[model samples]
Target: MIKVENLSYSFPQKDLYNSISFTLEEGEHCAFIGRNGSGKSTLIDIIMDPEKYIFEGKVEKESNCRIGYVSQFSQLDKIEETTVFQYIGEKFITLQNEIASICSEMETSSDIEPLLEKYQEALDAFAAINGDDFEKNINKNLNLANLNKCKDLRISELSGGEFKLIQVIKEMLNSPDLMIMDEPDVFLDFENLNSLKNLINSHKGTMLVITHNRYLLNHCFNKILHLENMELQEFEGSYIEYNFSLLQTKIEMQELAIADNEELERNEKLIEKLRDRATTDAEGARGKTLRVRVKIHERLEKRRIKAPFIDIKHPNFRFFIDNKIEETVALKVSDYSVSFDELLLENVNFEIKSNEKVAIIGPNGTGKTTLLREIFENNNPSIEINEAMEVAYLSQLQGETLKESNTIMEEFLEAGLKTYEDVTDYISDYGFEEDALNQKIGSLSGGEKNILQIAKVTASQGNFLLLDEPTSHLDTYSQIALEKALEEYKGAILMISHDFYTVVNCMDSVLIIEDKTIRKTNIKKFKKMIYASHFDKGYLETEQKKKLVETRIEKALKEADFITAKELSEELEELIKLL
Candidate 1:
């Protein structure tokens, strides 16, 4: 129950929002989406505390409306020793303890009236949160999330994904009127992501989630708030429906654009003819007609169609290599094992041939990142690399590849970029603005940092790439671009990813880690396994059909076969409804 009207904000570098407005109605589940560094999080901050930001907007909330928030990056360092149950029930426990202390003081104090008042206030606060059912509620939520086993586990014992879910449950248990989660699905594994989907679906109050995960986008939201090009579009429909509408609009706009261009060409020719006639005429009538035609041409130019949102600026990702190793195994892992306090992976083995694109996939805390890092370091006895192969790594933790204190230009320069001009020209293809070159790497958004990592890795011109969660913080557009880039790459790739779409679209095969061992599976089986585990039955088949139809539509449009394109678009609309 909040509304923003006529909102506009800007930083010194550029404008962020231009008179954007949207409303979060009661019980509405809205997905907030946009490109990286588009100020989605900053807008959230403004909504959370309007007084903290100086902007032109009216942010109004219902009186006494309670709100809960989960930030993009949440760390449990301070509460690492607390149990999951204790963490979730901290507020209930505090009120309970306070009430108990006051009652005990009332039993032996001369000022019993004051003690009694304090005890009543504590009880009221506790009851307001349904404290009588606190334990039961906690157990129910944990079971609902399939996290009952983690109730007694210390925070330090949980995986990052599990801990994030716990934080979400903690906020939900507070029973706030509205919840705002910023990229809550960032690093979650497939199973945990499914649990998150269920949680969002079952939520009774309003929610505004910022996420780029395809699974979540396809399954979770009833409304979509797309922020692009400093403008906001609020669509009251499923994400699939919204996407279909945008596609239909794009097609219509293209048709109109063609007609408009044709009209402009005709007008220009007529204007030129009139000008030529004026040069040859003895009277001023031809000159007057030419001036009138020139004004009409200018008006037509002003009314020319601008590209739609489908043409939003996205990084043009390209991966290059210095040399190719033909028909040879680029990397091999033989009887590899790694452990930290406990055995995480044992007897793991995999190989990547030259020009092969493979993905290493598993649940959280399954040693995917560790294995990728070890492979990149090339110090393990069990790991082997071709002598001529050059390696480059993109770590999930950006700090591993990028220096925090260095500016974007300085970082590239340190990476052997010859000059500032060279760095600027190179990063431009990766979607970095020229002004961004002077900003510290640490100040960039998560998606921006990930893009920088990819740019740096590509610049190395390595024939063997070890990528750890390369798609983690990227926007959907960049993710698609990366899939295309990886498909076209003429090098070996061993990537660690939890993104099902990326793995399915880009990789030829998968090395799955389970039960402390590694096994290989083809892309078809991987697709089936993922659908069976995380999605509805037959969903994959339908998606495949939809993808095929979409490709046909694109081909028809390119060949100027509007009839076939229209038929395919209608077919695609039906297919989207099935999804």
Candidate 2:
């Protein structure tokens, strides 16, 4: 349990939080959400350790509480040199060392009273932290996540997502009373994100997470702490509930502002007219009118309400298909298989027709990215692209492709689509300000980089788009903006994304990559399949068989085969599991 009061914090150049106050109770899960540079991260940092930050705030905590923190980028140079097991083991190293010292002291010292007391204290501390079950807990979680393979591998060999997972797992093993996770959704694929979500939701302690992943916010959090206009607002519900409440608040505030403005204007005009008449009137009547005007002015000043802060700015993403572009299938892949040291995908067949939007959804390391790369990079005979279809690709690895030396303006100019003036207007639509144009690409934050990447690809004005996780690292506003743009795009879209919202809204069809094969289906159908699959193979298989039985039963009835219909009905009953 933690409570922050009158939390006023300021950086060297700007004030971020002004009298922001909130309390996170035991076992409460809160999502801290705000736009970029809104001090969500700074608040988390202050909570983690108030001493580290120069601020006027009272951070009250339950005594003897252990806090576990997982940063957005949990980087450690030493992680590269250590094996995964060793890295994870280091989390409990201090406890282990303390216990070891206690044991050593007990064995060597003859001082019975002090030695026994110290030994008992150390043991109690170890047991209180769940030290005895640490390894078992680690292995169980790792196995559940299908990350057991990383146990023996060095941390350096792990992928970006894997490293983040390990860091989170290590913290969870610490058994802290409170967990503060900053952007835990970063770099994670769909399956891994789900796994992480399950892990976090199962945590019995309190949580304060700063993330932009809607899935996490909707599923994991019970409360929403929105940092806006340099204030912390506590909403006692999920993100969806918070959003509805915010919309209603805005509506109410706007109505009030309108009424208040009308009243103020009327009062001012009446006062002015009274003054003009008073100048030509007798002294007694003039004094009375003057008193009435002062009273009216005082009332108006007391009741005047400031207008609500409603930010309407968002990244502008407009994608257009050239009229001269071909109207045929933009991409076709048939009997295609990709391999590295081992075969990642096999016999994949799909086609994206002009103006069609398709999404590829799969578990992490299932070669969704690999397949996309192979489709675009490899010159296989089985894969065909329409000659008239100019391709634009948005790779997930934007940090690698974007040049650090180039300024924001220079980067857009390098795309060669528009002049300096044109580029400024183009990037600003994506939340880049006039001042940001001169900022080097290297200095951009992850979200800024994501927007820049999107800007560049959209600027290309190609007829076909291949986006790999374009929604990752994007805030909700930016994601919605990009989604709207993609929805309006006339070009064909083939995206590999883990964000289910993006899939449901942007894609008409889905390419599900699993077991080295690809299955194409509509978005709604795929959802049913995935839901059934979560139960196990038996449930999904039974559901499929039930559908078949129903079809047979319908056909038998249609043909007036009463005996066959009865038999199929019995089969259907057996296959149907209680929903």
Candidate 3:
């Protein structure tokens, strides 16, 4: 349905795409994946309207095709006062008016046979397009997004998640021939992300999604369009297959490049030796000159192979302990009842031991961040912290919190540093070279800002760390780097993040906030529970049986009862079948 040929674009610093070409057939669902600062978003914008950019590309859409787009950061803007009902109602204005007119005609007219036929046709059309059940589906989607309570609220009054939900719903309602979503996974939590995955999977129209969320790519898309080093490559398979093939291809390319470079060096060295021999030996000078010329020509004709591009850098993070902490319990929360106009959590209790790493997970807008802040600020009476513990909380990166006028060097110095020399090593750990230190903070990209936030939090050097979505805007490489650092951190860590991959990699235990209650589970058990929940409808029953059998088996083994242990193992096998 969409074809892009010889697409080339460039920014002031570098080329984003160069002579890249791709095509999307009718009903094709493809995912665009790349690291941060890649031109995924830019390419989507250009595809939406080629005239908007001064680029060398021909983007052709089938004539009369209506394209719908949901931007990553769409806002209500001047329509903030619009109500949810009114906002969605606007899409079906004509149909609603027609239905009302037909009903009015049937109510008052004496000769209603002609009107009856017209009304039946119009109603059928509405029903076919789901116009008749629009309100019901709206409520269903609102509940999925946890915005059912805000169905009557104005756009201005809605939370961030609700706004994103409205935008997604609006685009879905349009039912355009082609739908384009740029980084649609940004603000979604687990529940909402699942809803979006289902939506995209059920969509019949063509789709192009640019996202870094592996869960979405794995479930929603069937094709992969990878952008790397100003080139575009298409893979006709799942993200898992694409990732594996990409790594293998890169390794092969690197080997080929190394062999080519070695051969070129050898030829150049031989040519130099032959030239020297020609000058020293008068008898074979002509023969040596021809050999030298031939070798030099061969060297000139050889093509240089570029090495594979891999941008993985390690981040050096240090957490300093100011005082010795011998307390076994780093933090304890008991009888905690929290509410903000609604009961978010009630009568919940949990504890974090010294050097324990716990991940706080829940649906979006479920007060995970609020819980962390309450602990960090010590504002809740139900919470307690060890007196010897020093806490450092990493806030979410919002707008430009630093002064725009200051340079990166100046901002680091503002963190109570004596001089730039003191934090130079620290700054380098964030991938910032000395030249970038003089650049204005305002000029930094979203990914750069996220790295700076991590650096700032690390500078605090507290043993008890509270991180809220620390990997929010980081790229794949940076996210992995951050995860590795967190794994090695010798501090009491409690973090609220929606990145499930990072959570599984860095957290040893999980504190789940669900239905106004807190549930504790170790990493391995939690992973199995989630996997079963997705696959089985009888998850709770299977989980209970598995737990009971495991407990019995452990006791039997401890008591050296071989017969009982063997019986319990058989029971466990049967229970696994149920799961």
Candidate 4:
């Protein structure tokens, strides 16, 4: 259990909080939600007591019990001078060494049977601590991370997602009474994502989740603590309650603080006048003062003093283009072969056109990623000669490609951005904080790396964009932001993601990838289509209920049978609707 009474915090230069109060009861799960730079991590730092933040008022925590913390870093860094496995395995070494030490201390005891019993007890405790299981679980966590047989690998060699999995495994091994995870879902592949959900769901003690993954928050958490205006407000309901409540609060703040149309226009005009100055001594000092005054006015116009109401909704927008599909050949594939050992794609044939947003999907290791890379890598991305086309792709494994030496700011600057403000504004749209911009590429979290990769595609403004599992580690708000950016993009796009919410948002057509071929569909369909294609080696075999007039399968069978399958599927759909 943790308790905070009349607690307050702030920065040296700015007031982040003013006398906030909250208690995190034992077995309580809470979510801390806020926009960029609203002090979410600062609150986590206060909880961790990282020696950087100062806290006022009574704060009590259960000492003696181990506290497991997974901070906001996309991945865990291997600062320890140890191998990757050893670094993860080092967590229980202290307990192991203690057991060995206790045995040595007891070896000199007088009573023989009692000493033997004590020795056995130490052994049991040592066994229960799982020193050996630590090594195995380390491998298991890496496998879940999609890293192939990475046991002897160095932690320094792994990327952000790979490193984070190591730290998460170590935290799981500790099995502390209270687990504090700040955005643990960042950079995890699907298996690890599920593992994290199970980890949170199956835990018996307190879980303080400071995350943006609404799916996990909605499914597992019992309470929500929103960090806004430097205060943590508790919500006693589901994650849905917090989500709606948080959005509503922002809208209320907007209403309360931001001026109406006429006043905003007047302020804008005054600010605009400051930009255009007379090149004369007459306007010198007064113009400088006017510019300073305009900046203060802008900040004043944006800041809200009143406590925001938790019952409002804000407008949502997504990038969209009016497109018509007149051709069946949106995309053409001939002799498309990609592989890792076995053939992934060979003599594959598929066509894509305007009417559908096809999800390029396949299980991990099924060459879904390989095929997508080939599709994008092809020189003929467009059909018309001398016609320009834009194509963009966000690879799920894009984090693996980051250069260790470059800072985030350098990447943005290299991507054709001319100004710091422009770079910050665009990166901020993907839920990246300003502090994150300076983080070395190697130190960024898996989620941050994914955000950066997506940011690159969004920044690139390509016409035919490809995204690979863009929602794997993203928070809900970040997911929505990507949805909006993709919706407004004008050009052709090919996306690969497993997040159903995102699939529904950006997909104009569904392109289900199975066995190196693509099955395309339109958006107007059932949710059942989302995961139906994952089935192995069997179509949903159907037979007509009524007496069949010469079964199409028995008669024409090859071409007609495939066509019959389509028509029969449509008929079956109609029948289900009628029922």
Candidate 5:
């Protein structure tokens, strides 16, 4: 439906893409993936409106091919007062009303021909979108998403995730030939994320979604379009197949590189010796041999394997603490309740012991964020914390904790870094370049801002941390790095997250919100709940074993025990097959 040929784009600071080409064929669901700030969204913008950009590329689309876009940051600012049903059918209603108006005018107008023409045009437009059955389709979609109960609710009453899904429904009802959703799965709870997966699978038209959510990556897309190091790779397979292919290619490439290096070194030594002999004996035969060897060395250099995208550097995330809390409870909440227009939680009680890690998980609009904020504020009579613990918070809304107008360097300076050198040295570990120091935070990508939040929180030297949806915008590499960092953190953590992997791999337990109260559950039960709800019943068990074997393989490789690594690799393959 859409094709981009030899596309090259650049910003003032760096070139984003070079000669990248891809096609979105009809009925193909493609995942657009890359590291943060690698220009995934910008490329989408260029495809949607090529005239707005100054670049070298040819973007072609089928004539009259309609395109629907759901951007990363979308809000219902002006339409908050409308009911969900009305909002989804707003376009159809508008067209029907226009046609009725034209018919009423025809009853008294002298120019009946123009009125009739206008009436027919409106009817044709409405029919093009199957507007005659819009209400039925809307109800069906609502039921499929398990959101039929919310049909009469006002847009303002919906949570962030619900609002995002509603926007998706609105676009789908438009019946565009191609749909492009940029990070549409951000901030969605597990159930809602599953709803999105079902919607994508049932979609009949072409789709190009830019997302880094691992669950969706594993389950949704049939095609993968990976952008890395200013190049694009199009793979016609599932993400798992694509990943396995890359791993096999990496192993083969490394082996070839090793052999090539050995031969090159041997040729260098032989050339050195031949030159020395030619200088002593005035025969010049050694010189001819050396010339031939030099050509051979040049050929070897030309054929050397370049580093692949798998070797890209990931940010180093380290959460440190200046003082440890020895108290039994780092945080405690008893008989706590929170409400805005309605009561979301009542008589909720929970405690996090010193050095403990816990996750707050529930469906959307269940007051998880509100409860976390209340704990951070610590003004409620029911909430308490140890006096010896210092706390730091990472807000899901980056704007709450970061000043948009300030440059990266200035923000770090305000956070207590005394010198420019200190700011540069501190952010380097989080993957910020020297040139980024002068760039305004407002211009940075969503993932970059989140990384900045993490860096700031680490600098606070707090013994307790509150993180809300910390992995929402992060790429897979950074997310894995963060899991490692949180595993090693000495401080206590009370995190609010919808990411299943983050909770399973990092937290000791989960505080589930249900029936307007809090209940703590161990990680084992949480794992079973997730698997049963989203996958096969035994999938979690197999995945856990795979993780253990993978960890052992990493250790074996580091210790130069190739035999053990090979054995563990075989075990991991068996586990993957089960998954």
Candidate 6:
């Protein structure tokens, strides 16, 4: 639907691109992707003709084809004064104006034949863009984006995530022939992101999305536009193909360098032989020439430094932390609820037992962390907690239980842990090196700090653990290593995390805080609820729908995998009876 020919752009110091070109087919969903500093955003801006970016390219399209572009950066001021409802209505008004403009032009024309043709063409274009659903789609997608719930909420009051989603819904309603997005999944999680994928798949138009999340790339993209060396190339494969190509190219370059080094080595040996023959035998002038040749060979050798080949493949890691739990209740709350002024959660009941590794999962601002903090305060109404119980907390920002000037080793020692062999063993066990031990806790990576905190937990005498987004900043390897350690933990565990891999591995049961209620369900049952709820949402339908439904059925087919199989059965029975 959109084509760019001989696209070129550059800066004063560098040529960003030269003769880059691509074609977006009528229904192709293309992912415009590259590394962080690869000028992906600049290309989108160039295509959209936003501002005065220097470029030399000719973008041609089907005549009068409407294009809707949603960039990553939100323009708050552009729509802040408009209410969500009014903004939704504006989509219809814009289409109506286009229709009226065509009608008005037809009335002003003298030639009946040409004017009638022009009016018909304009009307066809309008219909082609599905102008009829402009308002219906606006309201439907707006509600999906939660703009309906925030009707009274001003644009200024919207959160960063809410604002991003709002604009996406607005752009979708425009029904452009082509939609362009950059970092479209920036603030979205698994559920909302799946919603976007469904939207893209259902739309008949073309799309070009630029994003950094590999998960999104793997799930949604059919083809990839890999940018390298100021050129454009069409590769017919998923994101995995691009990653493999990048790896192969790097390996090939390293091998070529090695071959070049061997050639230089052979030349140096020849020079040495020539020098020895001239000096020891006859030909005095030849000796001088050979000496000069040797010097040249030395300079050449100096220019080509032999570097050890490094193969660095960052493997994605997913950790499993679940170990069998002891059959004893570690904590319990009956009819639990907390209210700050007006917000109240009542009739909440849940239990955690020894040896059980559990997590409280929910969306942001859903008060998952608040529930954890309340436990430390003896479920107190207003009193804040500080060292209320023998628990360790890792907040979302990882801004808890750490201090400046405190070495990892010192912190471990201070935790009242068992005797250690200079703290290196403990740190290394969690995947940190000896060098990282002496470093102040302030500058450590999130993973490094997480490892240290895990070490602290092992060293301390605390039997019950309280963690908030404990795995938030950890890389896959560190997460898995910690998970392995938790598998053998003698005490109970409680965490609030959105890391799907980690949670799936470690959690025996789930404590879900959704829609202002707390519910306890075994991991298998919770997984069923997620799928059923998704199907209930209307995104997963047809074959995908059948697959999700079948998977849930198979899970139900299995006997209880956890200790609460009987309890879950009774819960299901009660739910069925109510229905």
lDDT-best of 1 and 2? 1
Strongest candidate by TM-score: 1
Runs in model 5 lying further than 4 Å from the true structure: 274-283, 325-327, 552-578
lDDT of 4 at 209: 78
Encode model 1's per-residue lDDT on 547-573: one tens digit a residue. 999889778877767778788889999
Across 219-334, the per-residue lDDT of candidate 2 in tens digits comes to 78889888766877788887755654554344455556667788878878887877887886737787688778779778777876553234445677888665435468888999
Give per-residue CA lDDT, model 3, range 1-579, as digits (tens). 889999899977557898999999878889987666667878988988888899897889899777889887757788799888777556666677898899998999999999999988877667655786777777766665556777788888776656776777777776677899887777577666776776787678889988777678757787988877788888887775565455444444555666677777777777677766667664586666757677666755565554224333445555566654664899999999878878889899999987899999887767888888889999778999988778888766444345667788888899766787776767987777676688877766566777777787778778888988888767666787888889988778999877777888789899998899899999888777666655457755675777688778657655656667667766776765564
TM-scores for every candidate against the unseen true structure: 0.96, 0.79, 0.76, 0.60, 0.94, 0.53
lDDT of 4 by residue, 154-272 (tens): 76655455566567667766667777887776545444556566556656677787676655665678887776556667788777555444443434444444444456677767766
Q: Give model 3's clash tally.
A: 0
Candidate 6 C-alpha error for residue 22, in Å: 4.4
Each model's number of backbone clashes? 0, 4, 0, 30, 0, 2
For all candidates in order, the CA lDDT equals 0.89, 0.78, 0.76, 0.61, 0.88, 0.62
Better of 3 and 6 by lDDT: 3
User: Compared with the true structure, what per-residue lDDT tens digits does model 5 show for residues 424-536?
Assistant: 99999999889889999999999989999999999998999999999989988899999999999988999999998899998999999899898999999998888887898
Worst 10 residues of 3 by lDDT: 305-314
Worst lDDT window (10 residues) for model 4? 538-547
* TM-score (C-alpha, index-matched) for candidate 3: 0.76
Ranking by lDDT: 1, 5, 2, 3, 6, 4
Candidate 5 clash pair list? none
> Model 6 over residues 35-58: C-alpha lDDT tens digits?
333467778777776356756778
| Model 2 alpha-carbon miss at residue 372, Å | 2.9
Worst 10 residues of 5 by lDDT: 246-255
Give the higher-TM-score candidate: 4 or 6. Answer: 4
Question: Number of clashing pairs, model 6?
Answer: 2
Instruction: Report the lDDT of model 2 for residue 162.
Output: 79
Distance from true position, residue 531, model 5, in Å? 1.4
